[model samples]
Every structure is written in structure tokens, then in C-alpha cells.
Target: MTVTRFAPSPNGPLHLGHAWSAIVGHDRAKADGGEFLLRIEDIDGARSRADLADEFRRDLEWLRLDYREVAPQSQRVATYRDAADSLRAMGLLYPCRCTRAEIAAAATRMGPDGPVYPQTCLHRPIAPGPGVVWRLDVEQAADLCGQLTWTDERRGEQVARPELFGDVVLWRKDAPASYHLAATIDDAADGITCVTRGLDLFHATHIHRLLQALLGIEPPVWHHHALLVEADGRKLAKRRDAPALAERRLAGEDGRSVAAELRHGLLDTGISFADTLLLDA
Candidate 1:
């Protein structure tokens, strides 16, 4: 059976942008007679608000989205650690002690996800410890699994270029697992056949494709739908204080109507669909 998931971090309340993404995944699964899953990405440690997870459920309920809940990332530390250990054993991971400010100051050029890591810690021989992060040796990893590819439902086949991101983090010193490692493992664990998410993360799929190859897992077809953006063209984000869905619910707005509007590419004032191609089609 086809499976798709809406994995949201519980660090903040659900907004309209989040609702659109959830609806896309939920409706897609329903359309295909497949299963829809909801996974809480609460692995950000202290930054993750446990209470917000409950709010997320409430929001989804208000939106009338049906989904099966999966174990949150906090409950899957061992899984991530086991995966990290496997990669380490294969000599594909190394410990990095560089701080964010230090990396920004030292980085000479940028890549898809900001400044490419300069490999300062690649040859440092640093041992895994409390204060160090684990980074994938992207060069070595690509060599091991040469000429990898993944398919996007809309964009067709893509050549995986994991090296573009440099040695990306697999495990963080403050969190149990980085987004790349945890999300990839969770999708495979849940037997997800369709990876549905926003286009902002389109580039991250390159790294995900590489991880799938290294771990010997079957790759899923991707559907990177367009994002909902403000009139200024910036994407709606919690950090930017975007309007929350809870407010609309509290105002007694009809959730189903709102969802229907979103399906037709209509949204509130000052907010619009960034792109309509293949959205709820």
C-alpha cells in the first residue's frame, strides 16, 4: 500500500502553511486508498515543546484530517543511534567540533544549505564526545554509492548530489539526531512510499537519496509541493510569527471551508500559494 506522512515539529503551533501540507498528504493517501501517517518531529531537545504536540493534534482534528499517529522522534533515540553506529562502522562518519559561528567565519563559499562545511574537522581525528557533532563524509559516501537517483512526482528523475551540501550533520551534539538522519529512517521504518513535503526542502532530498543508498533502503517517490508564501514572497514560518491555525479555529471559522479554499488555491489576505502546479490535482 502507498503511504505518505505529515511530519511536523512540535516547537510551535500549526499555521495555514502547515495545514496545506497536511491536507496534501492526507488527501493524496486517501485518493490512492493508502495510509496517511502523522509523525511528530520532536527531536530538537529543549527547543521542542511537548505541549505543542497536543495542539498539533487539535489543529489536525479541527482541519478534519484523518491520520495514524506514529512514535515521536524523542521515543526513537536508539534507532537513530544504531543507524549512526552503522555509518560510523563503515567509516562514513566523523566527529566535528566546529561551532556555528566558527563555521560561518571559516567557510569560504556557500552551497544549497548555506555555507558548505570546509571539512576542517574531517582530518582533525576528533573522537566522538559530548560536545562534538557527527558529520557524514559526503565524498566517501558518494564514492561508495555512485550514480544514485530519486524520482519526484512532478519533476521527474533527479541525480543525487549529496556532495553539494558538503559534510552535512547526521547527529547533533544537542539533539539525538539531525533532520536528515531521523526523517530518512522514520520514512523507511514506516514503509512510506510517497515522501510528501514542501519545495523549500527540495534540495535536502539530495542528501536523503544518498542516505537511502548507504543504508540499503528502498527509495520513495517524492512530491515536493509548492509553499504558501506571503505577499513579500517569504515563506510562512513560525519563527517569523505567522498567523496560527488555532486562532482561526478559536474564531469559529469553518475548518472544512478553509481546507476547500486551500485546495482551490485561495487563501487569506496577504498570503498566497507560491505555486499551483500539481497542488491537490
Candidate 2:
């Protein structure tokens, strides 16, 4: 059976964009007789909160977008560590000690996207810096998987150029796995044969696909759906101006109304969303 998940960060309340992503993820998997999992990606300790996590679960369940299993990235530290160690053993991983200022200076000298590390620290001592970030060297990655191709159900044939994803970071200096690492690892472990997510991450297909190749895993079939946008035509974000889902729910608006608003908001984006998903809620 196919498996897919709607992973959300608990730093803030779920917004209209999240609702749309949840509905599409759950509905698409169910339609194919697959399992839908709920993953709480709260690895960022500085921003993650128990209260927000509780609201995350509450919000999805309140919308009736149930999942077969639930897991949190915070609880999977060992998994990330093991993966990093394996990459290190393969010599595909590097410890980067560059600070923000150093990077900015390099950028100023080399031009934007400039300085790109110059790979200065690639073979040098990290000099016991404040923090270290683990990066996967892309050239080594490409030698492992030449020319990867990902076909999304909606966007079709997406390709990742080797240069764009070079030296991608997998973990921050503090040992917490970056979003790129945690997400791909969870998807692989959960048997997610089909991955459905928003279009805003549409470019991530290349990064994830590259990571899959480096990790000796097969890329899952992707389905990048239209994103939930605001009236100003901006993509909705939790930290920004998107309407809060919890607030909307508490303000006497039912799930149906929220779903309608989402569908209407995404009308120009060319995706079919059903209001019936809210009927049971």
C-alpha cells in the first residue's frame, strides 16, 4: 500500500494553507486506498512548543483529516545521527564552521551565491567554532547518482542540476537535523511511496531527490499541488499574514466554511478541492 504524510511544524497555529495541504494529502491517499500519516516536524527546539504541537493535532483532527500513524522528528534524533554518521563514513559529509559574518564577507567578495564556501573548510580543521553544520558535498553526491529525474503528478518531470544543490547541509551545528535531512529520512522510513505536498516546496524535489540518491534510496512519486494563497496573492506562511485556522475555527466558522474559503482562494491555481471533506467535521 502507498503511504503519504502531512508534516507540519508546530511553531505556530495551523493556517488556511496548512488546512488545504492537509485536506489534499489525506484525501489523495485515501482515494488510492493508501495510508496517511501525520508527522510533527518539531526538530527546531528553539521554535517548537508543546502547546503548539497540541494545537497541531487538534487542528488536523478537528478538520477530520485523520492519519494512520503519528510520529515526531524530535523523537527521532538517533535516526538522524545514524544517517549523518553513515554519510561521514562514506566521506560525503563535511563539518562546516563558517559563521554568518564569514559567509556574508565571502558573498560580498564573490557576488551573490558567491563565496559558496570556496569549500575552504572542506579539508581543513574546523578550528573549534561556535557551532558546526554538517553538509553533504554535492559533487561526491553526483558521482553517486548521475542525472536524477523526478516526475510529479501535477508539475511533471522535474530535474535537479548538480550545481544548485552542491554541499547541502543536513544538520545544524547543534546536531539537530535540518529540514532536508529529517523530512527525507522520515518519508523513507514511513514507506511513503507517494509524497504529496504544496507547490512552494516544488523546488525541493531536486534536493530531496539528490538526498535519496546519496542515501541509496529510491525517490518516491511526487504530487505537488497548488498552494493556498492570500487575497494579495501571496503564499500563506505560519509566520506571516495567513489567516489562522484555530482562530477561524473558534470564531464560529465551521470546517466547511474554511474549506470553501481555501478552495476559492486557490481557484486560479487549478486544483480541485472538495467541501465535502468538511461535512464530517
Candidate 3:
């Protein structure tokens, strides 16, 4: 059966964008008679709060989005640790002492996204160092993957160009698993066949695809829906409360009215498929 998931970070209150994503995931699953799962992506232990988790539960329920089951990421550290351990054994993960300052300075000097790291730590024969962050050895993994192909509901067939994205970090020093690893593992475990989320994650597909390739698994079909944006044309965030749903509800807005407004706004954003195709290329 086709399955989909709405994995939201429980670090803040759900907003209009979260509502749109929840509706999309639930409606898509209902249309296909599939299962919809709720995943709590609270891996950023330092930032996640229990109150935010409670608020998320309330907001999603208020929006009437149902799921088969919910998996809180904090409980799945062992799963991620195993993946890290296996990669460490395979030499695909390396311990780097690169600090945020080092990465920031490197990127700034490169003048913008300038291939941070320059793989300075790649061939270093140094022993496991302090602030050791685990990075995926993309070049070697690409040699194994050769080529990748995945289909998307909205974007059609997609190809990953690892050459464009060099070795990416899979786990931070303090976190056992990064967003890419934990999310993909959850999807595969839940047998999710469809992934419908906001377009903000389009760049992240490369990282996710590479990890899936390395783990020898097939990725789910992607449906990167246009995100809900504020009247200022900025994408809504969980942290920012520019146009939160709570405010709308406080302003006496109903679900039907909100959904209609969002649907209209999404298609009327002056962003046409033709334009997206050109830009995505």
C-alpha cells in the first residue's frame, strides 16, 4: 500500500505552512487509500522542548489531520547510532574537528557556498579529533551508486548529481544522526511511498538521495508542494509567527475558508510550472 508521512520538527508551534503540509499528506493518503504517518523530527535535542511537542499535538489535532502512528525521533537514537557505527566501520564516515567558525570562515572566503571544507579534513591522517563531526564520503559512495533515478508525483523523474554536492555532513558532533539520516530511516522503516513536503527542502533531496543510495534502499516518490507564505511573500516558518494558524483561528477563521485561501494563494503565487521547470533545471 502507498504510504506517506508528515514529519515536522517539534521545536515550535505549527503554522499555516504546517497545516498545508499536513493536509497534503493526509489528503494524498486518503485519495490513494493509503496510510498517513506522523513523525516527530525532534533530533535537535538541544532546541526541542516538551511544550512545543504539546503544542504540535494540539495544533495538528485542531487541524484534524490523522495518522496511523506517531514516532518521536528522540526515541530512535539507537537506530541512528547503528547506522553511524556501520558507516564508521566502512570508513564512509570521518571524524572532523572543523568548528562552526572554521566552516563559516571557509565559506565566506570562498565568497558564498564556496565548497566549504575543501575536504581539508578528507585526507588528514590525524587521529579522531575533538568536535568530531561525521561526514558522508560522497565521492566514494557515488562510485558505488554510479547513477540514481527516482520518481516524484509532482516533479516526475529526478536525477541526483553528487558531483554538484560534495561530501555532506551526516551527523553533527553533538547529534548522533543528522536530519537527512533520521528522516530517510524513518521513511524506509514506515514503508512510506510518497513524500509530500514544502519546496524549501528541494536542495535537501541531493543529500537524502545520496544517503539512500549508500544504504542500498529505494527512496519514496517526492511531491514537493509549494509552501505557505505570508502576505510578505516569505515562506512561513515554525518559529516565526507572521501568519500562524492560531492567529487565524483567533480571528475566527474556519478550516474550509483557510484551505480555500491557501489553495488559491499557492496557485496564484505568479509561480507557474513552466517557471519552476526552468528554475529547477
Backbone clash numbers for all candidates listed: 0, 1, 0
| Pairs of residues clashing in candidate 3 | none
TM-score of 3: 0.86
Q: How much is the lDDT of residue 173 in candidate 2?
A: 70
Cα lDDT tens digits for candidate 1, 194-280: 999998888899999999999988999999898999999888999999989988999999888889999998888999877543211
lDDT tens digits by residue: candidate 3, 67-183 = 766668888888888877877787787767776677766652331124446566887765764567778787887777788877767777878765454566777776668887888
What is candidate 2's lDDT per residue for 1-281, written digit by digit as tens?
77889898878888766888888788788887888888888877778887987887777777777686466898888998898888888988888887767865664233113344556567976653457787788787777889888888875686765455356678787548887888889999888888888766666667788888878787889887776555555567777845677886778766766665665663434334332111110
Top-TM-score candidate index = 1
Full-model lDDT for every candidate: 0.90, 0.74, 0.71
Instruction: For residue 9, give model 3's deviation from the true position in Å.
Output: 0.9
Model 2's number of clashes is: 1
The better-scoring model by TM-score among 1 and 3 is: 1
The regions of model 2 sitting more than 4 angstroms off are 108-118, 127-130, 264-281
